[model samples]
Target chain A: MTDFLYNYLHVYLFVALFMLFCGIVGVVYRRTLIGMLVSLELIMNGAGLNLVALNRFVSPENAYGTAFTLIIMGIAAAEAAVALGIIILIFRKYRHIEGGDLREMRD
Target chain B: MNFAEIIFLFIIAVTMGGAATAVLAGSVVYAIMGLVVTMFGVAALYVYLNSPFVALMQILIYVGAVTVLIAFAVMLVGPLYRRPKEWTTAGKFGAALGVALVSLLLFVRFVTETFPRAGAPSFEMTTKDIGRLFFDDLVLPFELISLLIVVAILGAIMLALFARGNK
Candidate 1:
């Protein structure tokens, strides 16, 4: 069991995949903009996990994958900031942040 | 199982449980708290994967900054008292479940078939290595990320100011 825990690469891969799955479910089922944003962060996290896992198991010598993961973090931070700003602006305009109520352009 | 394996299993449980709570919780603040839990679990996993620097950054940027920002946004938006509308009906839920299961099976099959079972060789990844790489080989992207953060900060401030001016 310990060997299985330490030696297997597929376990990490599956964990990352599961994170992606949960993120997708959240994205589809969530009704609020903030919920969707949270789900999106989960997706980004899944991607980061995949990168680090592959980097560790496949090529530990090169720092490329780690660097990429760092960059992803940077981008995720910026994205969250921008997304929150947009959410605030939306609340200011619409008076609510429900995903359904922003249907002014639907017509 | 050894201590390390037990700890790893615990971390996995924490991660999955936190993610479930983040998705299934009714309150947005509770969801954000779940996200913080999930972030900490991921950071612990990073340590197991031998990337302590990334782990630290994950905790710092994610739990430290992003979650706080999200919490502040939830507060700024005021109380969301109305029950969130169920966007996915039973039929949609079934469809989504089917798609997720199929994709997961396909990915598992692809991975098992494509990759060899040889274990990863252990190697040390010091903070020094990460720093040197950032400054030497990956300098341009590093600089670009700084620029991106500056732009994002300015844009967020501008957006908030614009909204205030509209009042």
Candidate 2:
């Protein structure tokens, strides 16, 4: 029974789905640029978890999933750097990094 | 469930709960801390999935490097405890609802399809195998990721410099 319970794939999938939902909520509700970036990271991790879980359970031989996950991590790190920089710049210019405050795009 | 299975469930619960808390928390510092806990849970899941190397990398990169950087970013640029406005934009509610529904569907599909075969497949791909595959089969992507990271760093620096100049 222990082995039976432990060897299933649904657990990872559910966890990944939960993370994705949490990320969506964060992205939607968060008012600050930094908060949005954090939510974006959560979403990216959810994607990585999906890839890893699928690779482990369904297609065991292909390292493509793991490789793709690693690449995603790299991309996420890059994204965070750019996002943080942009957030800081926006804060400096507008004196606010609140998502709602960036209403004016054209000057 | 046996002891191991129970432990696995506990770990998964911790991972999921932490991630949820991280996303839901109003305070950015709390969110970062929650992310650390979630990363711990993810590392455990990686171990359960039979990839210890990836587990360590997950902890190291996600928990250690990325979280710390974000924490520093939060601390450096903005008001840490001013309590950001909690109100969301108009269309955001509908978007969140849509994403939640889609995620629920995907979760159901995953659970239904998980139990096709009787047992775990007999495939042993170790860390050495991963290293070999990464270097041999995925050399281009590996090199390109490095290039991308470098460009991102440079762009970030330039943006910071430009922002400073305007002030």
Candidate 3:
């Protein structure tokens, strides 16, 4: 346990995996669009952490991996913004943003 | 264990706990709070990776912008504290569990085999390396990414307008 925890790669990997797990479960379980968006952010964070861990452990001198991680963060931000806008539009149209509420293409 | 290791363990625990709360909590508001905590913990882990810059970026972008955006969305939506009543069904919960379990089992076996890294695991990303990230490494991709973000935001605005025109 001690050695495993001491290894930076293993420790970060474990945390990232756990986050991914929670994100998956949350996405499936949450009925609201907002909750699903939150869960999706969790999944993106996990992927970023996974990339950073690999970069640090495999080739610390290189900056490309780290740059990619930052890009992933950028994508996550864009995704959140776009999703929120959609949520706002959905609420405006249907008066509710529950997943089940969005069952049809047109009234 | 040394003080740094202790801190690392604490961060790991915090991250795990926050993730659980964010997912399993009854309300969307509480999940947002949990997300803030989890993002902070993730930033700390970035520090452990020897890049304070990325760590700060994580805090700034995730904890600052993203969480705040989600909070605003929650407030804009009709209901705030909707308990996860739909999640009570056994089949949905079990399916998620089974997928996670299978992934973890397959991943842990390979993860346990530690790579042979050089002394002390401290691979400092120098300021020059950081500079290259902006100058040489990611200039074009960053531009394209920013453009994509702009397009997404614009599309969202367009969607809102369409929603209004329909009414």
iRMSD (1 decimal) for each model: 1.7, 2.0, 2.3
Ranking by DockQ: 1, 3, 2
In candidate 2, the second chain superimposes onto the true chain B with a TM-score of 0.86
Docking class of 3: medium
Cα RMSDs, all models: 2.3, 2.5, 2.6
DockQ leader: 1
> Of models 2 and 3, which has the larger DockQ?
3
In angstroms, the error of model 1 at A72 is 0.8
lDDT of 2 by residue, B118-139 (tens): 4566546687878888899999
Give the poorly placed runs of model 1, Cα more than 4 Å off: A1-4, A104-107, B83-88
| DockQ score for candidate 1 | 0.65
lDDT (Cα, tens digit) per residue for candidate 3, span B1-167: 67877888899899999999999887788888899899999999988777788899999999989999999997887654554343546787788888878888777776776554333355779667877777786789989998999998898888878887888
Over 4 Å off, model 2: A104-107, B85-95, B110-118
- Evaluate every candidate with DockQ and list the scores: 0.65, 0.60, 0.61
**How well is each residue in A11-32 modelled by candidate 2, as lDDT tens digits?**
6777888888888888887888
lDDT of 2 at A92: 73
Tell me the lDDT of model 3 at B93: 79
